[model samples]
Target: PGMGEAQAVPYLMGHVPEGVTAGTHYLQAISTGAVFMGAVTYIGNAPNFMVKAIAEEGGVPMPSFFGYMLRFSIPFLVVNFIILSLIFF
Candidate 1:
């Protein structure tokens, strides 16, 4: 279950290009970014799919995987990410 820190951290450390820190802050930043970016796709988060399933079963029409991205995530979340990047970087 601890795949991220156990396996991923080692693999990422080994593959990191020369001059890259691969330090605690960098790892934390990437981990946090991964969490935030997960919202970009339904499959990226398990509860998203579960909630979608529950809603559909209750007679709600949920968007398809790509439909959700194109209709909502790209327009809303991606724009916010762009703005955040501009401000932060």
Candidate 2:
């Protein structure tokens, strides 16, 4: 949850399906993960940090990491992901 596709591509590349070649399937896997999972946490993408910086600069109180997790991420994203996976995947 603390990365973007630029940082996550390598791991996705390494975990490609056994039969999949280094072309369409490989790219698809990386892209899909980047799109869906990228929103799971504040550090999951570049914009998150930018937003935090801007908010703090503007004097808006931002949630701490653990607080964000407990108050928002886990309660919303994780549960929604589980339900979505069960229904779709």
Candidate 3:
């Protein structure tokens, strides 16, 4: 769940669930999760760190890790993922 999508896609591709097609819905769901996972943690993706640094340099007061998780990831990203699951998977 934490790994970046570029590296995690292989895991999804390799560990296909029983009865699930490798190239269809299952793969799509896994790919979506992997991509969305970047928003879950500050270190979860490279661009996040870069963006955080840029924001800080520009005088933005960023949240702590856990604060970010609770305020941003949990409230917004997770909800969006749930919606994605309901609509697509």
Candidate 4:
């Protein structure tokens, strides 16, 4: 009941999307989708910024936010995320 949607098992309790059912299968799919989409941009994921900070401190020049998306995420992650969404969500 309390924070059930946080685990994706809202089930007539927590906040759910407009048409999505509150269930284990949807929960898993949504969680997986969140992970995949979060990789699409630095700001989308907190760990990305942490890693960038660590790498820069170590003398590795990380791309800027948009640059990372243009050079890496869009080319690498977006397509895969799209495919995953199509298949799962």
Candidate 5:
């Protein structure tokens, strides 16, 4: 599911039933609880509104769902392979 645009975009474009083009399609993947817990604490999950309130208190502007992941979580995901290699091998 973690695929780069170069690979996934073309495959998805090619598989589009018959008449669709790459320009007409969009794809995105999201991780809900897993990613949410990574950046913020577990408290972030229990009290959703409280998280927002605290962020505002700290002057941290909350990003949109996808925006938050792209800015923060994607970097972690990109380097996760290296982390795995270090741990396992």
Candidate 6:
């Protein structure tokens, strides 16, 4: 989320720490929050469009919002969690 970069930059560079950096931290927090929410439901970004287009083309009714998440995003959530933990924690 570029948090490491944002925090490290000022700290390492020894600039005056403006409280404005809180905005950068806030953005990273929001992004992670969105990812968590989107993992449990389909309400973010391009996924809904792609899912709708493919479903329509295949003559399948679009899955319900949470249904889509249960089928697809849960698995991805697991994988993403594993990858992030390995890489960051």
lDDT of 6: 0.69
- Candidate ranking under TM-score, highest first, comes to 3, 1, 4, 2, 6, 5
What lDDT score belongs to each candidate, Candidate 1 first? 0.83, 0.78, 0.88, 0.80, 0.57, 0.69
Q: Residue 59 CA error for candidate 2 (Å)?
A: 0.4
Model 4 TM-score, 2 decimals = 0.62
What would the per-residue lDDT of candidate 4 be over residues 25-80, giving only the tens digit for each residue?
87888898788787788888788889999999999988998898899988889888
- Judged by whole-model lDDT over C-alpha atoms, candidate 3 comes out at 0.88
State candidate 3's TM-score. 0.69
Give stretches of model 6 more than 4 Å off.
1-15, 18-30, 45-58
**Model 5 Cα lDDT, one tens digit per residue, 1-89:** 68887899898867778865544322211343345345443234556557867897899988766765677556775467446445644
Model 2, global lDDT = 0.78
Expressed as tens digits, the lDDT of each residue in 1-89 for candidate 6 is 55686689778668755564646656765676567656556556677678778888999987777777777777877568667656654
Leading candidate by TM-score: 3
Model 1 segments more than 4 A misplaced: 1-29
Per-prediction tally of clashes: 0, 0, 0, 0, 0, 0
If both were scored by lDDT, which would come out higher, candidate 3 or candidate 6? 3
- Residue range with the least summed lDDT across 10 consecutive positions in model 5: 24-33
TM-score of candidate 6 versus the correct structure, residues matched by position: 0.40
Error of 4 at 43 (Å): 2.3
Candidate 1, residues 1-89: lDDT per residue as tens digits?
A: 45666788888878878886647666766775686689889988999999999999999999998899999999998888778656654
lDDT of 3 by residue, 1-89 (tens): 58997988888878876787547877798899998887799999988889989999999999888989999999999999999899988
Q: Which residue pairs come into collision in candidate 5?
A: none
In the range 1-89, model 2's lDDT, one tens digit per residue, is 68897979988878887876657665765665576577777888889889989999999999986887789888888787768656654
TM-score (all chains, Cα) for each model: 0.65, 0.60, 0.69, 0.62, 0.33, 0.40
The root-mean-square deviation over C-alpha atoms between each candidate and the true structure, in angstroms, is 6.9, 9.6, 8.6, 6.5, 13.8, 8.9
